[model samples]
Target: MYLTPSMAKLVHEFNKLPGIGPKTAQRLAFHILKISATEARVLASAIIEVKDRITNCPICYNITEDSPCSICKDTTRDHGLICVVEQPSDIIAMEKTRVYKGDYHVLQGAISPLDGIRPDNLRINELLMRIQQEKVKEIIIATDSDVEGEATALYLERLLRTMVARVSRIAHGIPIGSNIEYTDEVTLSKALESRRIL
Candidate 1:
């Protein structure tokens, strides 16, 4: 099917989004065309609003509309404990659990040499500066369980171990309701390694 120039432009812009393929982008573009001008304005305004207002927290680098994010401003939480993650989105996942009452640091991305992302490309210096300036007692590595996540965690560990704080990685293993028999080798290995005395 041949798209008009306008439709093609819309599809092209949508295709630039992560996880959006040509077909999906085309579908989304068609959906946009179906919506009312008011709805389109609302959607477009939302995107623009986020880009204009959201900024990284000065202390932790989490996305925020305020100067520092609420988590960073909350002095009741443990300022000395920091949970490190790849992105600000990860902080949302951690917050949903309500188990951690500590501060956070967003690395913004993981270490992926293939993508040309290195330690210097991340907010690592900021993290180290936070450790030195604050009386931090622990640094938790909560990156994803991928190869890049592992590399980033290892790199952070080596640097953090020399600090006065305890450095630890979040355990990776089988999820709830999953069968051990069907588990992959890496998952099984991690599960076994993370086991504690009953």
Candidate 2:
């Protein structure tokens, strides 16, 4: 039987999300259909609220309700050393380890020339500006161990060589081609502790 218009539409929308296949999308759409109208409304409202209320932290480029973000505002965090990651999710993962006391800078994306993403496309310039303006002493590149991430970190290392701040790369305890978010807490903590100078 042909699917109804609304069901088809919902499935299409769900399919647009990352890693959600057509089968999973259909399952979710049907699941939503079975839920109470109030619950569905709550889910929809939650999604809308995030879009309307949450924003990128201007200082670190992480997602937050505030422009500066909690990490940037926290007095206890080390302002002299900054951990640089490719995305906001990576920052969240690192924070979960609770071993990192330094502030962070989300590069927003990695350099992938094959995909047309370049240094100019990322927040690299913003990082450089922050290092200079804040007199940052060290930068730990915690980007993913994938090819694109490696390329991005190398590019940053080269650009930061002449700068006063010491540049370092996060340890390779994380599997090659794996993102930080997937790494375990112990591994992440060790990576932070064993970070090597570039």
Candidate 3:
């Protein structure tokens, strides 16, 4: 199967993206080819614009167009309460809930010995610095319920126990509307352990 130089280049670029298989890359390349030149240019420009404008917030390490990010800047939000997460995407998920009214601290990544990620690699020191500087009353570990997320949360809890007034982990369990029969063993156990009295 021979592809033109330009088409091959496009396919290669698309394949570089995570979870994009060769067939999907080829499909994307063909879709790009089918689109008008103006639309293609717009797509290219949007990518370039994001690369040029987007950057991490210095305080919380969340991806943003500004340095501090809007969340860090907002005085109306509860700066005393900090919800710490492993990635910027997790912050988006939390925001979608719309019930939380506090600040966030993105650790950039979780500790995973298999992946060579350690405490030094994450923003742990920065979090400690924020605790010392800011009048934070509570620290909520909002990492994923996976092994790496648990490890990172435990490490943070141990480090922050004496420093902050309260340290807690976000409850992990089967999601709302999910069937018990469909849920995994660990999820069911966690749900049972975290159960509350109505």
Q: Candidates' TM-scores?
A: 0.94, 0.86, 0.96
Rank list by lDDT? 3, 1, 2
Residue-by-residue lDDT tens digits, candidate 2, 39-135: 9999999999999998888889999998789999999989998999998989879999999999999898999988889899998889888987997
Off by over 4 Å in 2: 174-198
Segments in model 3 whose C-alpha atoms lie over 4 Å from true places? none
Question: What lDDT tens digits, residue by residue, belong to model 3 across residues 37-81?
Answer: 999999999999999999999899899998789999998899999
List model 1 lDDT by residue over 1-198, tens digit each.
899999999999999999999999999999999999999999999999999999999989999999888999997999989999999889999999999999999999999999999999999999999998999999999998889999999999998899945998998899889899999998999899989998
Q: Give the winner by TM-score.
A: 3
Best prediction by lDDT? 3
* Candidate 3 structure lDDT: 0.95
Give every collision pair in model 3: none
Tell me the lDDT of candidate 1. Answer: 0.94
Question: lDDT at 196 for candidate 1?
Answer: 94
RMSD, every candidate, angstroms: 1.4, 5.7, 1.0
